[model samples]
Target: MTLTEEFDQSLLPGELILLESAKLFGATNISPNAKQWEYTRKFPIDELRQAIQRGFGSIELPQIFGGPGFSFGTKMRIAEELSKFDLAFTFALIQHHNALVRVAELSPSDHSRELIASMLTGDLIGCTAMSEPEAGSDFSSLKTVAKKVAGGWILNGKKGWITNATDANVCLTYAQTDTSLGSKGIACFVVLGDKEGFIRQAGYELHGAHAAGVGGYGLVDYFVPDALVLYAPGLAFKTALQGVNRARIHVTAMNAGMLESSLSIATQYGENRRAFGKSILEFQGLAWSLANVATSLEAMRSLAYRGARQIMRGEDALDSAAIAKKFGNEQTLSGVAACMQAMGANGLRAEYPLARHLAAAKLLSYTDGTVEMMNERISGAVKKRYVL
Candidate 1:
């Protein structure tokens, strides 16, 4: 049976519909089905083109903007299932909307229409142009600059670790308005991918997300018109983290999906193979390890759904969302490892899903917000109650 068929029978009907829709959209460009993201490292433009043709690019925009206006719940469901298939592909799709949120929140209505139209028609792709090589976690240390000029602005300095690099149609970028204001001096800019002097530099041949084919940009006097600005000077960085938190939660759900995929594959292998004169599941130790995976996965789903519901209700789930993200990523990794061990050496083989699941957990856990950052956020919440 196809995975979608299995999904329909296993997931709730509503969830099944969402997954089927995403699948039909070809929103995922991850290759090898059960293995790794092959196209990204090499820039699988052909498959990506097919995905765009399938409407993968416009999944979340408002209908008037050529998007589906899907609820956060629906998005979370799609992200989780897509991550089960391919994390890099899921990451690529989410970056576009993450970039769009700035436009949605601040762009002039006309600019909004233009950008949203491009997004819907697959004429525009986007990348987040934050994160210099030196300013990993300490965003305050970011040094890219944007200087105002007549009728426009001049962007200078390098943007390191860009996911889509120079190939994207646009970049949701942040730059320093004035060094005197430091991190708070940061202003957001919407720069076109084809802008002059905006060069994508070498690097980002990564240890993971290989299909991402990541790189960076060296912005040398790239002039972006004031017409292209998404947020007013210094506004985006102030609110930048809210978007990051949302992405973190989405990434957590993706990790949960990957782990879920691996666990099912592992369990099937365990049941089929004989170990010590019986299936590995027959061993009490192995059985209990499998039980841990089940319990942890259930917990992950509960927390993720709670976070999604809380967000939909406009509740403050920042701390709780981080907790869910951290919990799901951590537990999923532990479970994948356990399942791998239960499968013996065969689990380490590329054909098995657990290996890729472990890699995916590592990627998501570190990418959106580090687990340590999540802990600090949680600690702040605790401290706010005078319990730190």
Candidate 2:
């Protein structure tokens, strides 16, 4: 049996159906053109719009808001299935879905009613901007400033490493209303991309994963009316923290998916390819290497689901999420590389997804949170959780 079939038996029947649907969606819509999108550095806007029709645009939005409102565990499963095909494209979809949830749940009813509708229909794409040129992991150090003015606030700053930046028309932007108050001074605003002062900057040329549309933009005196504020000072930072656990778990699932894909490819090649007058799988060395990756992949899957379940149950998941992300990041990077090494020269070929998966594994290590940041979180809780 395939790795997914063996590993996913723990899922509920309904969740399995959704996962199968996501698998089919990725195979039909994303897998075929993922290489081309990477080669040409295109964002696959049309395909993402098609994904919205398939119910991928609003995975976490409430049913009242016209979304599937699936549990957090189910959403992570779907994310794993999609990421098996392509991490960059899957990440873009996740970002868009997250933005939809943020707006529907946080924005004022009268202000977001129409905006949410357009987003669901894919007429308007969305993204969140938190990291700036000078601040990423240390978000409190962000220099983006928002000054209060008549009728609205004027924002000025540049956001970098944002997903869907090139095509997004609606942005959830965070700016400091007062630097002295640090994180407490941060505020979130709905900044329309078409506004006069919103500047779309050129995208970054990464080594791979270009379908993410990772880019940056500048907000030059961008005016956001009082009605557009999602979180005023003293509340925005806490709101952002509330979502970090979910984000970390989602990224862990993606890492597991990528590792699964790479291992499957390498295993298939080892079983079929012949060397020294026998199948390469006959070689004890190569076989054990692949076996190690398989074991770690299962462990990563378990950690991902554990964190997801905690969030679903409304339990404290900060430590679980950090541990899962930290383990997944370290394992996936090494695991994908081990899979590639098992394939020899064939692994480097563009025809296989191994190369792309490897690059994506490295890129994902920094997403959601970095390994160092995860370590800090886990280390802080070690004495409290372990001593008892």
Candidate 3:
């Protein structure tokens, strides 16, 4: 069966609506030349803006805030469907959605109402800046400091590997207000890109997802007045960790979509290309490999949707999210590699998407949180709950 047939049978009406919207957006704007755009590192700003205007990216925001107010399961399906067409482009939209969600959580504040309005109208772009060069996985080691001043706080330090940093209109940033307290001293703030002392620097030469603007920046004594502070000291990291549970769910959905796409490509190629007096797929080795890929995809989807259901019910999902993210992302890489191997030289070609899918998998594996961190979290949770 085809991807659509499988999806149509499984998804609800609301979920199908978002999937159709994503397919239309991808067909019109992204799928045609996604490879060339990835190669040239050119972000499709106008197309993406149109997508946001069409309500494709902000579905998770509450209806009170001009969003569709969909369930978390619907959000995951949206990410998965969009990613099947283009991982980098889907990622850009996912990042924007995440920022909108963060703004919603931090609303009723001075700047949030206006900012969220602008985001829904596509007048602004949003991103998160938390990772620094020296503080990849260890939030405790972040050196960016927000020194309390007479009027407000003076921010200083640099952040690296920030998605959408070069193009975002606003950033949700975290910094230490009291290094003596380590992670406990961390605070969050809303920093406008056009503001003075907020520098947008160039990102590394990337292998994939160039359109996502994975870059870095420095805050040179940037003064953020009290009005712009989102989370006070001792609360920034808490908010960040709270956000991760949902982010991991979307990340898993993205990986599953890419894996399904890769499998489809391999399946189509294997049926048509013949060797040894028969189709390659007729061989048990290749046939079983594809079967295993399908099985793995189903397993990942089960884990991801279980976590999404928990989140929808307002229950704790950290453990489920970690398991889904770690297993989903890791399996996506392996599955996509198998698909590429099935296609042989064609998979390596830039014209095909397998190679780019591999790059996207690697990119996601490191971001959000690493597999090692997930293992630690699960082990800790298990020990705390199961100890007699």
Candidate 4:
């Protein structure tokens, strides 16, 4: 049986249908072109537009906003399915969808509403910018400053390591309005990329996952009207934290999906390739290695599902999300390597995705939040929960 069949019984019929469609979309559009995209570092804009046309761009957007309004659990499953084929494209798609959701639900301006209409059609792509050259996890230390003007705010700073930064036309930017208040001084604004002062920086040449369009940009005297403010200083930082739990869970699901793909490829090759007058599967050592990978994949799925359930129930998922991300970070890196080893020399070939998955796995270790950050978060709760 396929890996998804093991858990299909637990999913709702509608969710299953969505998953099937996502799988088909990946096979038709992503898997075939992933190698080429990586080699040339090309952004998959056409495929991204197709995905938006098919409703992947607004999975969790409210029905009132003309979106399918799928549950958060379903969204997580879709993310997993798409990621199995290509994590770079899947990550970019998720970021765009999130930007759409933020504008649709949070922005009160008519200009934002018009942008949402364009985003839904893929005419305009969107992204969030939070990281800077001097600040990553340290949100309170961001140097980007937003000075209040007569009509709105004048933003001046640079953002780095942002997903979809190379091609996005609408940016949800975060900047500090006051230095003394630290994190509380942070605010979020809708900055149009085509405007005068917003400058798109050169894209990064990543070791892998190039389709993600990961890059940075600079805002020099960029002006955002008061109507475009999504979150004021007092609430912007908290809003960002609230989204972290879901983001962590999404990354965990992606790791699980990649592990599943790697295990399947390695297992098939081991069963078919003969060595020493017999299939490699006959060797106890190789069989046990794949078995361990399978076990880890199952555990990863369980943690991802648990975290997703917590978010669906509107419970505080900080601990669960941290645990899930930490476990995935440790297992996926080693697990994919083990799968690559099982195939011997063939694993390193460009035809096989194992090498790519390996690099992406390392990259993901630093995505969302670093493994060290996860440990720091979990350590804070250890005494409260474990001592009992």
lDDT of each: 0.71, 0.89, 0.84, 0.90
Candidate 4 clashing pairs, residues 3+ apart or interchain: none
Which of 3 and 4 is the better model by TM-score? 4
Better of 2 and 4 by TM-score: 4
Where in model 3 is the C-alpha error above 4 Å? 1-15, 106-111, 385-388
User: Candidate 1: misplaced stretches above 4 Å?
Assistant: 1-18, 23-40, 104-112, 386-388
1-388 per-residue lDDT for model 2 (tens digits): 6445554666678667777888899999899999999999998999998887678878778889998777777778888888989999999988999999988866556668988998998889999999988999998888889999999999999999999998898999999999899999999999999989999988899999899989999999999998888889999999898888899998999999999999999999989999999999999998999889988998898888878878888998899999999999999999999999989999999889989998998898898789999999999899777785
- Cα RMSD for predicted model 2: 1.9
Give the higher-lDDT candidate: 1 or 4.
Answer: 4
- Model 4: lDDT to the true structure: 0.90
Candidate 4 residue 12 C-alpha distance from true site, Å: 4.7
Report the lDDT tens digits of candidate 3 across residue range 192-211: 88899999898567989887
TM-score ranking from best candidate downward: 4, 2, 3, 1
Candidate 4 stretches with Cα past 4 Å from truth are 1-13, 386-388
Q: Candidate 2 — number of clashing residue pairs?
A: 0
Clashing pairs in 1: 40-211, 41-211, 187-234
Estimate, for each residue in 209-276, the C-alpha lDDT of model 1 and write its tens digit: 65454677878898988877776756767677776767766776787787777788888998999957
Model 3 lowest lDDT segment of ten: 2-11
Best by lDDT: 4
> Candidate 2, which segments miss by more than 4 Å at Cα?
1-16, 107-110, 386-388
> Tens-digit lDDT track for model 4 on 1-388?
5435655656678777877888899999999999999999998999999998888888888887878778887778888888888889999999999999999856556786788889999999999888998899887799999999999999999999999999999899999999999899999998998998999998899899889999999999999998888899989899898898899998999999899999999999999999999999999999999999999998889899888878988999999999999999899999999999999999999898888888888888888889999999999899777785
